[model samples]
Target: MDRPELPLAQLHAFLVLAEELHFGHAAERLGIAQPPLSQQIRRLEDKVGHALFARTPGRVDLTPAGRELLPAARRALAELADGLAAARAAGSGRTGRLRLGFAASLAFTVLPGLLHAHRERFPDVRLEIREMTTAPQLAALRERRIDAGLLREPPPDEPELKFMTVLSERFVAVLPAGHPLARHRTVEVAALADAPFVMLPRASGPGLHDRIVELCREAGFVPQVAQHAVEWQTVCALVEAGLGVSLAPAGIRRIRLKGVAFRAIEPGARTRVAVAWRADDTSPLVAGLLATMSEAGPTAAPPAARPAPR
Candidate 1:
């Protein structure tokens, strides 16, 4: 028979009948009345010009043609299934280029583990990592400029985004070695009520900086801001210069500033870093990155006051 004239539906019906060895059950699986299924089978047999099954009172067995075609049919279906699984996985960013966004600090620390695990599981996936702040990352995600983000918590007010809090890290107060609070076992957040501070850019990580401010407020007064340094490294450098104290997560300890000291903040002051993407976007690449990040989990922790909430 010419390929163009072949009835795929009948072939499918024939394959189902072979598996079930029963007309009614195969019909049920196909969601059609049994009579129609039987007619379809008859048509298929007519096309093949042969009887495909032996009909007995309680049993149905494959005839020569049926026996011959069964394995071929199954092999074809198996090929289709394998092809589809690979296509689906590839379509979902699991196989192709993936644009991943993160902060400068995250790139050296957690991003390494995330990239390692992500690529190991999906070796074919090409990774593009961009270092950007939480705000720009959010904008790029919304504009379809980036596939997914790994950053400190997003602006809490972004109703258009859905985020998951993956992991939380404790706050580490960075101070000059001789600073008054550096000698304590665990520095109380309250002790910094009047302390001058270095902070991340208020526009870029307002949610995080605000949480730090709120923590200070809970301790009794608004934190005194002496300088606003954007990057974690910048904050560490400023602290080393004895400009002011800075509060960051434990991850910041990786920076080896000569005169800076790191002490864990008491009462567990934390900044929440999350993975964010457009809640309604339907890109498979986005889903793939999300799956990767979901499997990657969160980086870390915090809560409290804000001038303009993020």
Candidate 2:
């Protein structure tokens, strides 16, 4: 025969009455009248198909069937309570997973501090970080492959994504350590006008690439591209090999390439790093991260630009 479904209220009454061994006391403890408590226990006994208590005018005692059901009832209630608590914690974003995408160059700038602060505040939240360039990060955000992104120069036309600038840095020139201009405290943009340039492909990071080209135009000349690299480290490495000069965010100076020099540029150009997420996302995990970013402040100071290895 199939077992009857037991109601939680009756199980609660049975447990209480079993413990007190007095209907009047258990009813008082349960904040119900003695007659209702008796009804609850009787109803439970009917479902259980056995008398749960041996009653007398003076005292109450448990039957063997009641003894067996007692432990199982406690476990069921405890497990339900635990499950409810876990659901609440996940809904509040105190425990869950957040998949984030970031531009590789950000590691030298705001990435570490931001991640550290988030971990400290939401320790139970699992952070999954993916290193990608700006274009790929944007595509990932649109496709829901990532919950959030840390990227440079977020396009203003992306109405579907909300962006907040987390860092801004001025551009710096990268040159071969032995190049003549490497000896100067600062290199004028116009001075590199005739030099062959090593640059990140425009397709990978259009914003930064176009900004460099715009700065060159403002300096009354266009950069003569001699090579292209996909990452800042590679761009610096190519410059170290004497392939060409390049312009990069000041943070790129931290790469510490032995044969490359980083110098401040004249008529400074700047780039922004932003945190972005889909505007329509309502997940508390996303909200928790956005709140942490707001509390940390709108912008972080980039590492001070310094002359490197000349």
Candidate 3:
């Protein structure tokens, strides 16, 4: 069924004139002349089939109908303004929901800085952050389950994903608190050549896991396997338990953990983390977030690796 069109212009004039009670003042407020303001009120009253105002030679006052409409008019205008604001915000990508998948380890690294920057610029954009390993995050992006992701380097064979590097940090060795190697500010990877290595499973973050192994191999001897865990925190925890020493991202040193010692690795082996999104996705929110990251850049500085808790 068709609805009756509201005479918004006339209603606005009526509200202004009602508040001022004088046509000249109302017209001045509306940036119009008094003749047009009176005509607008007359048209509105005719449409309502009620005498909205009882006008005297020099005074005007609202009738019962005009009084009843004042509150509704105010509410309608407020709702319309709110609706327009919401539309503008969504159009500019300043507000709305964005699903983001990230590697679990990034919580301590670049993620915090990136999130803070985005929020500072677009506080209304709701971010749904999920922790997934790189492979799963890539799959999620391909399946359209998430809008974007932060993960290790993309697979060489996958062409559907686009990525931008946001961080690169060297690897550090995490050792048992009392281990002799912890006394050194820096240690050669070959020094841990025979040391049992705690590591993440191959499937958890293959790029990083294999990179650690590759670093070990480059040092002239294969690392002896000691223990394997899924999360970086767990890997550090195992290192703390004296289960085995492990090589982790230098950022992991920022995590406050007891019984573990961190030391810089020789030759400064570094790994990268990047933001990834589907190549075909032209979502403004995703674009906006990428722009924010570009502006925020990397965190100020990576903290120096420190020794065990004393």
| lDDT against the true structure, each candidate | 0.78, 0.89, 0.85
TM-score of each: 0.67, 0.92, 0.82
* Candidate 1 structure quality by residue, lDDT tens digits, 1-310: 4643436687788899999999888899999999998888888788778888888987888999989978877777778789999898777656777787898877545777777877777788888989899888989988988878877867768887888776576777778878877776668888887778899877987778788878787878787889987788898998899889977877777788768888777677666767777888777766766676687566543222111211
Q: Native-vs-model 3 lDDT?
A: 0.85
Give one digit per residue, the lDDT tens place, for model 3 in 127-151: 9999999878988999999999998
Stretches of candidate 3 exceeding 4 Å from the true structure: 1-3, 33-39, 156-159, 178-180, 221-226, 255-258, 280-288, 299-304, 307-310
Considering TM-score, where higher is better, how would the candidates rank from best to worst?
A: 2, 3, 1
Which stretches of model 1 miss by more than 4 angstroms? 1-89, 296-310
- Candidate 3: C-alpha RMSD to true structure equals 3.3
lDDT of 1 at 217: 79
Tens-place lDDT digits, model 2, residues 1-310? 7878988898888888988999999999999999999999999999888998999889999999999999998888888889999899899998999999998888988888889999999999999999999899889999999999998888879988999877878888898999999888788999998899999898987888888899999999999999998989999999999999998988888898889888888977788888999999999999999889888776644543565444
Candidate structures ordered by lDDT, highest first: 2, 3, 1
- Candidate 1 vs candidate 2, lDDT winner: 2
